[model samples]
Target: MIHSINNLLYFRQKNPGIRGSGISVNDPVLLPVLSELENLKTSLENYLSDKVEKLKIEISKGQANFPSILHVSILPRNQKVSNGIYVVMCFDILGRGILVGCAESITNPKGLNTVIRKQRGIKLNIDVDGLRPTTKYNNVFENPREFYFGSIDEKQLLDHISLSLDIALYNLGLAKKDDLTIAEKADTGANDQAFDPQNLADARTKIARQITARRGQKSFRDQLLRAYEYKCAVTGCDVVSTLEACHIMPYKGDQTNHIQNGLLLRSDIHILFDLGFLTINYKNKTVILNKEITSSYYGQFKAKKIFLPKKPSDHPHLDALKFHNEHEFKQG
Candidate 1:
């Protein structure tokens, strides 16, 4: 449901925007909206908004296949963005293109060339500040498109952008890489840890099997504590008995057994994390608390980065963090 302005539905007209007004997708109605987006761009990189207003915002419209596209690049500021990464938006004055736009991070270095345009995709987040229950799913952008144009709430549209950015980050190996120190991947399938038929003949054998299972659980806990330097990743609760090795992703076969799938949290935090009331935003390197616990002690830890393993190899896999964010982490 991530609606974009440049989606292939509009391709007939030639005029993308008003001329000499700073933007190529020339629509006076969207002036306020663009201003807001500029604010977001500056907030993201900071240096984009220096004391001098000498920032040259190179503006151009899409030609050939994309007639409705308005390509704006903030020049001399974000070399990473203005260089190859550009903000491509569809000016929706005619009711065909979407009001929401995207900041593309394409692989092409030269940018604006015809070849890169043909491939399509690579983007980020931008959110309107006032929209209570605002859309900040992954990478929280301070100011975004919904500041002005259109009727009704555009929070969903902004959320769609954040969601897309989350996916892109996961795919590009830029985020969500968690590696557990002590916990091993669980054998989640029915076949795994299934009692052998021969061993089930006696009650004593069944007891022994149960003991073995407990031992395996202990191993998982031991490894997690070691990975986290024997302290709770959340509260620094060093009480070994109170610490628990918890899985970020739910147990779902051998795939959950990987060490990167686990997190060493205090018992209370582990329970909360499992319940989706608490989570770690690995990209931001901070802890996130759901509304249910926002007023509690856990909330105090909000925006505070958690402790990670010392070794790079021990870092959790990026995919695991992404999974926890999308499917588990509760956010605005």
Candidate 2:
């Protein structure tokens, strides 16, 4: 039943002179058990390998230096297990150890925790926020969850592990590596549309998170509103609460949050802007509609000029407008 070499060594270390006359370290009876363990390891590896490859991320050796382990960089650099080692999870004969770094980033951490507890009969030893720091493995995890092999069928356990990995990868996709600014971290918990349909209930959740960050970052929106005279740059809507601040270039750091790199737009227009259905021409500062939207209600704004700030210094930077037009604007 020993699937790892470490287990064998630990056993021998604890019991020195306990072998029978016919029982040696290399007993023939042990060979079949080791062979069966090897088959199990292969099955687990193959199952995980396919999942890893689909995520376009590679798996590496576990920092624990244990056999049958897999490590992935699902967390950001700050929360990594170590400087160069980002082992979010590791595997062994018993079961899996997951860092669960995305626990806070998930839209419904409590609900997901309840599901895991009910379905797997295992409760994550999580803090109030579903994240608890651990000094184990030398400060390895801020939030950790362990699932050991038990009465549950091995195949079922593996399936649950795979699903958990998918959830981690889904959050990882929303995380942009270039933008490590602390201001954006709160939005990381937004649900991945690919993982759940709840995203449709609040369609604005995606860009709204980027705009508001929902963590006392009202200054960014307030500044944009002041610069644009509390109006939607495109529609000229004067509702203060209905307008949002959007970044011309995705927020990379605090420096990118400048007024020149922002747009004050109505909620729906901000969604269209983020989705690339509409953009502003850098040269004339006129609204440019993607050809696909020319027949839609949005078509009226096709050559419409966007409202510009009175002070040229407060106007959207031409370079920022060019970047979006070239990179994000959908011409068709």
Q: What are the clashing pairs of model 2? A: 105-189
Q: Write the per-residue lDDT of candidate 2 for residues 209-316, one digit (tens) a residue.
A: 442242223456767888899899999998665688788887765677789999999989999899998999999999999888899999989889999889899999
lDDT of 2: 0.51
User: Where is model 1 more than 4 Å wrong at Cα?
Assistant: 1-215
lDDT of each: 0.47, 0.51
Give the TM-score of each candidate.
Answer: 0.36, 0.39
Question: How would you encode candidate 1's per-residue C-alpha lDDT over 272-304 as one tens digit per residue?
Answer: 889888888868668888887888777788777
Worst 10 residues of 1 by lDDT: 111-120
Q: Give the per-residue Cα lDDT of candidate 1 at 109.
A: 28
For candidate 1, give the lDDT of residue 31.
55
